[model samples]
Target chain A: MNSAISVRHLTKDFRIGIRGLKLRAVDDLSLEIPRGQVYGLLGPNGCGKSTTLKVVLGLVSATAGEISILGEPSATSAARRRTGFLPEAPYFHKFLTGRELVRYCAQLSGVAASDLDAAVEDALGLAAMKEAAGRPIGTYSKGMLQRIGFAQAVVHDPELIILDEPTAGVDPVGSASIGRMIHAMRDKGKTVVLCSHLLGQVEQVCDRVAIMDRGKLVLEGAVEDVLSRRDRHVMTIEAMTPAARTAAEAALEAHGAKITSVTHPRRSLEDLFRELVTGSRDA
Target chain B: MKDSLRRTLWISRVTFLEAVRQRFFAFLLVLSAAMVLSSVSLRVFDFGHGELKFIADFGFGGMFFFGSVLAVVMTAQLFFSEIDNKTALTLLAKPLSRPEFLLGKFFGAWAVLGVFVLVLASLQGVVLWAREQELIAAAEQAGRIPTTFSIVGLCQLVLLQWLRLGVVIAIVLAISSLARTFLFTVVVGSLAVVAGQLQWIAQDAFLRPTDSPAYAAFLWISTRLIPNLQQFNLADALVLGSSAVEEGALIAVCLSGLAYLVAYLTLGSLIFRQREI
Candidate 1:
């Protein structure tokens, strides 16, 4: 279908304590994630973002609603066959090497025996884990673990990939690497639904964004449409003195324009960090 | 169907590998092996029984006790490690079903117990054979009938023990499906094993006419629901030839074990299908 994932007014509630108190985790959320785009689901902890994803993936049952993946019911294996998932803070068997883990996932995902090796190699190569694939998972750093987790998720070449907090504990370089991977998946005509607290990375990578707050969808739209103000404007000028700034403000006001504020452009700290550590990695 | 089976096989393969690498399995295997070896030295305390019989009983005791511990503790640990680590989230989000996942776990734990039984049974056989030869020579000198053990019976007992442990693993898995924590599963699984051992009491009480209907109903359900684990203790009859076990009776015991195993696995799968992850 045109929509890779469709959630229709989904709600999820959890019971807590011996008293059976109801805790609503997701409240009547509806979404239509378009195919072949990078979509971001963002929220603070306990805002029901993860719960929504879990319900969509059929890891948890919805309290009330309907969800479908690739035109099939969300809970069915037929739907999951076309979807891949990378859980937050992923943990793997420490005894298995990165290669073995990927291969095992491929087997579970039903990769044909003839294509298993090639599929595994391609996924590892995409995650930049081929070099360290032979090392046991226990020896992997947090960044390496995320990368290998990415490798396993995409090993079967699923049409839709859902990644939850893919860069939670990684350095800026690793985070950037994951951002690039999201971009590559989008380039390959695959639908990617990403959930992360890293708003900067989400803005950089997502074509569409949905924000959840307190178990409710507060905002959902294209990144540019939701984030940009049509009335606002910005310009960068080189080598301007105090007199030049006064003249520029006068010139703008004469044309029915007013500059709200003036300030020097500054590089984001993440950009500076990546620039400083471009050649070094925890891998 | 083939694809599902393939997925189950892969899961079980990983589960088996994870279990074998654990220090707990290694420690128990070594301890059981030591108990079997030390039985020869402790034969003087056999309390007037034949030396071969004492060795057999000691080794069988180690197998029964340690095998149950492994079946209960190790099975729960393996299942929980996946849940607590969130590996289940990664695996379950694929095209795999809940029943396939649980069955994979059952086979994996059962395989490890298979190794445990095989190793101990082989060692017991070696010890029995060596002692049998010694007794034969002593009997020739004193003109007495020598006590001997049956090799075929040892093999049969080994199979029965494996099946018994398989039943325990299934029961633990069924408990783990509903348990919120590993500790709960292990505690309840241990209690189930104990009940299975004493299940014959329920069976005996049910066979005799009882006046109380509630008591009879309870006994009736208990006898059917809990396996007669005591029935699998055929080592004395099978290995030492102390009594002749009819082939039909052995078959009946095996069928009973298989029935319990299937019933528990089916129950576990049903409960797990509704579990939240």
Candidate 2:
């Protein structure tokens, strides 16, 4: 199958002020995001990662180069019909209930009338927003807002989903819920592109990642390939006495190997928090 | 086509809901309604005009002034709110086209104006009818013909005013598409409304023979570009039967309103298509 998204030599320059000075937002960036995997696009603020996504999704026009989604021109409605997007810090009509907003979006996304009910319910179920779907969005907490935004994006059952800062300003528990939703999208064979600053969550969930800096791609590879150090190794030895440790090191030295350092394995703070607050939910 | 229409309607539905819920709409509606209701008490200063005509003038003035304000300010507010709040980001990312979004907003704001016209016209009609009955009784007792107003004419006026507001909304949308801020759109849109109201000056100058080709060319462009809003302000003639307006003329005005409405909306959408969301 074709890549879920193909961006070739995409550059974007925004004109600033009446003098028309050009400010380059993204410069000659190319990417091929594959299908059926969770991919993370990571960068600090103003690094053009968001601009690149916006260009791919056709929200902003590219200054030069080409882009396609599933073999179709990225800006065409046909391409957009098969894709979904949740913008960063999403804001919705405050008067609409969560269900109403989702249904409205589903219709706009071209969901067939016969399947709309099932599609809406399935989306709400996936986002864990079913209980609060009937309440007005003004009453929702930050987590509930993000979850409902996720539900709306997925309501039409698009093949590819792009979420920009889906967990920004959300607490850890809420962030974990979003992580689960991303996993669920991947499980259903949907391509997921996540843009976020939370590196720990990106490392945990992304199958592949591409890091951008100064409007250029600095690194792109499989998560394991990029994160693992090949020249160095660590082995965990449990319940070894001091004499045994000394014998093991001497034996390794004879084989031209040496133990560099020894320390107890530690769990990450996120893992510890999740473990201690097992039942806490943002809802 | 049907699917696109449905999508536009869905957008308009939500926009209408959002706009109607605003305290701004209610506040203006109440203020306009008060003006229309208070016209009955102000009939003493008729200035030599008929009593019903005086009342009708007061009521129409209220509708016109308040309706224009609503059209200019409210439409810009609605469009910019979506952009500033990033709600347009979500909606525009869908399969919905830029033209569809603009049309949806047009219809939504137009619908709110429809309600505004209806409520105020109904109140004005009631006040006129009540005063007419009293006048008719006294005139019959004095053996003179009682001056009256036409219900059908009032209805036509309502439709015309609604169309005028629709034109204003479309104009504002076009401005908002190119504008960077709400204040800019409103300022330019209000100026456009004023220009449209005075567009007949160019039309008159164009009618007179002129040797200056540059002046004629400027007038030609002005006449063609700025819609003549004065054509729709026949409330006194239409409502009070002060003069006879030909059917062909009314049709021409309606057609002109629709042409400008479609033209401005299309221009707005084209500009908006290039906007970086």
Candidate 3:
């Protein structure tokens, strides 16, 4: 299959003032987001990461370049029909119940009438929002809001899903829930592109990542390839007595090797929090 | 085509629901209703005009003023709220087109104005009906014919006013598409309404022969560009039957209103298509 999204020589310039001064938002960027994997696009603030995503989604016009989604030219309704987007800091109508909002999006996304109910319910179920789906969105907490936003984005069953900072301002528990959602999308053969500031979460969930700086790509590779140190290694030894440790060190020294450091493997705080607070949901 | 229309309808459905729930809509509805109801008490200062005529004039004036304000301010507020709140980010990122979004907003705000006009017109009808009965009784005792208002004409006036306000909403939406702030849209929209209300002056100037081609060209553009809002102000002819208006004239007014409505909405859609949401 073709890549989920393709961009070539994409550049976007925004005119700043009456004098027509130009500000370059995206400069000669090219990317090929592969299919059926979770891809993270990471950068600091104003690095043009969000602008690149918006250009791919056709929300903002590119001054020069070509973008295609799923083999179709981008910025067309036909191209967008098979794609879903969850924006950064999502805001929904306060008056609408979660279910209503999802249903509204499904219809707008061209969900067939016969399958609309099933699609909406399935989306809500996946986001774990089915229980609070009938309440007004104003009543939802920050985490619930993000979950509902996720539900709306996927309700149409788009083949490509792009989430921009889906977990911003969300607690770790909510963040974990979103990570699971991303995994679910990947399992279903959907292309998931995540733009996020949380490097740890992105490191955990993304199969591959691209880091940008100053409107240019600095690094792009598989997570393991980019992060692994080939010259060094780590080994975990359990239940080692003092005599056994001395013997291992002597064995290594005889083979012309030495241990630089020794320490126990420590679990991350996120893992510890999840373990201690098992079954505690944002609800 | 069918699916696009469906999307537009879904968007307008939410927009209309959001707009009607606003306290501003309810507040204006109450104020306009109060004006209609209070017209009965205020008839003493009619300055020697006919009783029913004064009442009709009072009600029509209330509808015109409040309906225009509601159209200009409410439409801008609805459009700007979606943009400033970043709700447009979510909605526009979907498969929905920019034109569809702008058209949805137009229809939604127009529907709210429809309710405003309907409620006030109904009140005006009731007040006129009550006074007509009393005047008929007194006139019968005095052996003189009683002057009464036409309910059918009042209904016609309601329809015309709704169309007029629809045009105003479309114009405001066009402005809001290019505007960055709510206050800007309102100020420009209010100014447009004032220009449209006085457009008849340019129309008259265009009719007279002019020596200067520059001035004639100015008048020509002015008359054609700004809709003749005065054409729809047929309260006397339509409601009170002060004079007989030709059928062709009424149809011409309706057609003019619809044309401007379509033209302005098209302009808004084109401008909004280029706008970066």
Deviation in Å, model 2, residue B273 alpha carbon: 1.3
lDDT of candidate 1 over A104-205, digit per residue (tens): 999999899999999999999999999999999999999999999999999999999999999999999999998888899999999999999899999999
Query: lDDT for model 3, on a 0 to 1 scale?
Result: 0.92
Q: Is candidate 1 or candidate 2 better by TM-score?
A: 1
> Measured against the native two-chain assembly using Cα atoms, what DockQ does each of the candidate structures obtain, in the order listed?
0.92, 0.91, 0.86
The C-alpha stretches of model 3 lying farther than 4 A from their native spots are A241-243
Candidate 3 residues A18-94, lDDT tens each? 99999888788888889998999999999899999888888889999999999988998888889988988888999
Question: Which DockQ-derived CAPRI band holds candidate 2?
Answer: high
Off by over 4 Å in 1: none
Residue pairs clashing, model 2? none
Model 3 steric clash pairs: none
Q: By DockQ, who's the top model here?
A: 1
Docking level for model 3: high
Which is the winner by TM-score between candidate 1 and candidate 3?
1
Model 1 lDDT, residue A187, Cα: 94
lDDT of 2 by residue, B24-91 (tens): 88999999999888888888899999999999999999999899999999999999999999999999
Report RMSD (Å) for each prediction in the order shown: 0.8, 1.1, 1.3
Per-residue error (Å), model 2, residue B260 = 0.8
What is the model-wide C-alpha lDDT for candidate 1? Answer: 0.95
